[model samples]
Target: MLHLGLGSFHRAHQAVYLHRLIASGDERWVLAGGNLRPDMADTLTALAGQGGRYTLETVTPDGTRDYEWITSIRHVLPYEPSLAGLIDVGADPRTRIISFTVTEGGYYLDGRNRLDLSNAELASDLDGRTQQTVYGGVAAILRERMRRDAGPVSLLNCDNLRHNGERFRAGLLEFLERRDEPGLLDWVAAHTTCPNGMVDRITPRPSPDVAERVRLVTGRHDAVPVMGESFIQWVIEDDFCAGRPAWETVGVQMVASVQPYEEAKIRILNGTHSCIAWAGTLAGCHFIHEGLSVPAIRRMAMDYVTDDVIPCLHSPESPSPIDLAAYRDTVLARFGNAAIRDTNQRVAMDGYSKIPGFIAPTVRERLAAGQPIAGVARLPALFLAFLQRWHRDELPYAYQDQGMDPAAARAICASADPVAALCADPVLWHELAGDARLTAAVRGAFDEVHTTFAGALHG
Candidate 1:
């Protein structure tokens, strides 16, 4: 296994799952971790110091907490020679699968959903000098594999993006299409399998208090102990490049197609996070737990789910019919977990990429059905307002421990002229602005919520 972007979430979720598999005598797979970004150097250093062993801590229902020592990762490799080094890593015949939790924006695809070769960051990397974008690295690797006739390797994408595997393949193909190689893209299309996957694990960054708690549990001081809720679910499309681990033995739902599950989760679980994160932050709540404690905010979130999200799900025809109430309760319990310390800012980060999958799909579906998106409409508008506030330097950036810079955030936020950003970014505004009614609804809700939320926060 070659795991890219070895961050806290990946460590606590997929890596931990593999660790559990290895612990239970499935030691055939070991992770050779790679870090693309610079901050992860410290994380790599920490994990390497401990021989790639780290603690995954979780909060329990009865106020007790527990920790597990995860040791599935074997080695760390920095991108020393940019694309060349990454190609070398991927060219290894023994590495049958490459998994990524590199986040949504990490792919560096442009608005047309093609490889953003024009991107300055991407152009620097593709020049093969010393730059290293995920696309550049993956493209370079695929080119080498095509050259060396290396056996197949699956590309497992564990992010929340819809049709992730298809997107990864498309992004890669877009890059390859620019090259003059004969039968290379065809060979890749025939060999490489990019599996769409739904990965859910509430791995929140641990606070200093939680760090001390880690010391009490493991007797070893861990600088970065990932605190997650006990709940986890992975639904994956049943496809592999060379082959795959017996992930089904553990708990993954390996299906012929993960589309239905992916659609359901992207709209419900991820959408709910967006709904609360912005409104929660604007309300001056420090974390999701704190937000849930607020009656109005909590009520709004529940209403949004029940009135808006639940009706859209493809439930079973059985008598049970998938109890949405039960699911919502579970979500509430997870969000309201005080010990988990899931921050609004952590959830609120990456609104640019997150909105298209989580919120926009529902809005688009509703518009197609000629249904008003009142309950659904408010959250997006509130999020936009939050973005404006986050931009204007009015709010202190939450979840700083997890790669959120207030200055950079402010700049991104400042770039968001709701009218301009939406019109320009099709991933967000194309479908949204196309619906005049929805756009009006969003603008109206934005005005009302912004006033109410701002007044409430300031008061």
Candidate 2:
């Protein structure tokens, strides 16, 4: 197996699953992928020095901890600006599955799910000037595999993006089309399969506390140590071009379709996670559990899913994909796991992504059905107020968002009707824009949160 974006989440989630499989004596698959950028040079070098072995610190809700040595990633190639190592792995006949976790913004998809060729990195890839973006490097590698007749491979996307596999496949094919390589494209069409999956693990960014704990317990100065909550979930589609490991035996929910699982996760877990992040920031909390501790915040999220999202998803005629009530309760409990110390800043980093991807789908569905959208609109309204705070330089921490325009966001917040201005963003609302009902719903939610959190700040 070849995995891209060997970051903290992969180490704490997918690698853990692979490690479990290895423990079960299935050692056929091993991970070999490297960072495309030089920013992670030190960390990548440390992991390679350690032979791709790292300590995983798992913390439970009750503060109990377990440390395990994760060795599923047997090879960590050197970092290259061109991602030549990654491309080589893609071309290798033995590599049956090439997976990636390039974050939500890395896919370069427009609202229509087409490749945004105008992006600087994408433009560079289209012009064949840089081979770094996951798609660019994958295209190059797929071409080499076709030339060598390297046989079939599966492309597993373990990111949070909804319909990730299909979207990525679309972007990659569009990318390949730019080169006019008809034969390679045809080979790609025949040889590669993209499987959509949903991954869940509360992996906070690596910090000094985790590294220090690892050293104190294990008496080893191991770098690349990752930490996550005790709970973990991975739901994958069982579509593979080549044979795959018995992941189902190892607790992977190998199902026929990933849509139901993906939808539930995005709307409930991810959506509420963002709600708490923004609301907690306003309430002057640092960690996610701290925010979730506030009864009103937690209740708001639960009610949103129970009263708004699940009803829209579950119908009288069809079976519900998940136990919505149980899932909602479990999600809150997981968020309240203080040992994980999931930060509001981390959860809030990609509001521009979450607002649309995680939160908007429920709103859109409710609006289309002529049902009440008031419950779902709170998530976006919280984000708008959060964005306003960031625009005014009031946020306590550094904020980063690849999908947001700082200047435009600030202007929107500064306008006479900031809430309305924010609602009209084409990047986020898209076709749903210009609807008076949504604007009013968002305004109501904005005032609701404002009276709660903003009042607390003033008090």
Candidate 3:
């Protein structure tokens, strides 16, 4: 197996599952992981130096912690601008599956799931100027595999994207089309499969304290130690073109279609996670636990799930009816985990993406059904306030976003009707901008936030 974007989540989630399989005497699948971006060079170096071994720290809500050595990643490839090593790994016949976790925004697709060729990095990649973007890197790898006839392969996307596999395939094929490589596109269609997947774990960045804890528990210096909540879940579409590990044996839910599980997770867990992040940041809180600890913030999140999302998702005749209330309570309990210091800044970084990806789905659904959106609109309202504060450089810590346009965002924040200006952003609100119901709901939510949350954040 070849894994890209070897970040904290990959180590804490997928690697841990594979580790379990390995411990149970299944060694057919091991991991070859590396970063596609340069920011994780330090982590790559540390993992490579340690022969792809790292300590995992799992924390319970009540502060109980456990440590384990995760050694499933047998190969740690170094990063390169050309992505030569990654391409080689992709082309290797023994590597039947190449999985990725490029976050929600890294696919470089617009809201319509079309390739955003206008992005400069993407433009360069498509023009053969670089092979850095996921599109660019994947295309290059596929070409080599086709040339060498590396046989059928599976591309598992373990991210929070809705119908991730289908969307990723669309963008990838479009990228190949732009490359004028009809042959490679056809080859991929005949030779590859992209399985939709949903992965969840509250993995925070490895703090210095985590490293120190690793040292105390284990007689080793683990610079790349990863910490997460004890709870984790992975649901994948069982459509591997080549073959896949017995992931089910290790508790992976291999389903025929992961849509039900994916939608429920995106709306309940991911959407509420964003709610906590934005609310937590606005409330001058350092961590997700602190945010969820706020009674009002926590209740708002629960209401979003119980009142808005649950109704949309729970259906009697459907194949899978969700226990959304149970999921909401479980998510709140996870967020309130003090030992897992999931940061507001980390969770809050991608509001632009989250607004559309996680929150807006519920907003759009509720508006069409003439249902109460007061609980749902809070996500975008909190985000708009968060964005305005970001415009004023008022965020407590440094942050970046794929959807940020500093000048335009600042202008909107300073407009006579900042909330309206924000609501009308074609990229974020989509067609909902003209809807009277949405506009009013969002504005009311924003005002109510100030009335209710201003003190907690300011104090």
Best to worst by lDDT, what's the order? 3, 2, 1
Give a tens-digit lDDT track for model 3, residues 1-459: 999899999999999999999999999999998877788898899899999999999998899999999999999999998788999998999999999897777778777779876678888989998888888888888899999999999988988889999999998999988999999999999999999998989899888999998898887888788999899999998999888999999999999888888998898889988899998888889999998988989889988888899888876655355576777788888888888888898898877778888888888888888888999988888988888788777888987787666777888888988778878887777778657788788899998898877664331
Ranked candidates (TM-score, high to low): 3, 2, 1
Per-residue lDDT of candidate 1, residues 98-198 (tens digit): 88886676776544577755466666765655446666667667778878888888888988888889888887776666654457778778878998898
Candidate 3 worst ten-residue window by lDDT: 315-324
Better of 1 and 2 by lDDT: 2
Clash pairs detected, candidate 3: none
Residue-wise lDDT of candidate 2 within 1-459, one digit each (tens)?
Answer: 888878899999999899999999998888887776676788889999999999999998889999999999988978776677877887899999999887787887767887877678888988888877888878877888887888999999998999999889988888888878888888888998999999999999888889899999999898789999999999999889987878888899998899988898888899999899999998889999999989888878888998898987789886686898898899899999988888899989877777778887888889888899888888888888888778778899998887777778888888989888988987788788757989999999988988888654321
Quote the positional error of residue 269 for candidate 2 in Å. 0.2
Q: Point out the higher-scoring one by lDDT: 1 or 3.
A: 3
Predicted structure 2: clash tally:
0
Candidate 2 matches the true fold with a TM-score of: 0.97
> Backbone clashes per model, in order?
0, 0, 0
Q: After superposition, how far is residue 424 of candidate 3 from its true place, in Å?
A: 1.2
The list of candidate 2 runs beyond 4 A from truth reads 455-459
TM-score of 3: 0.97
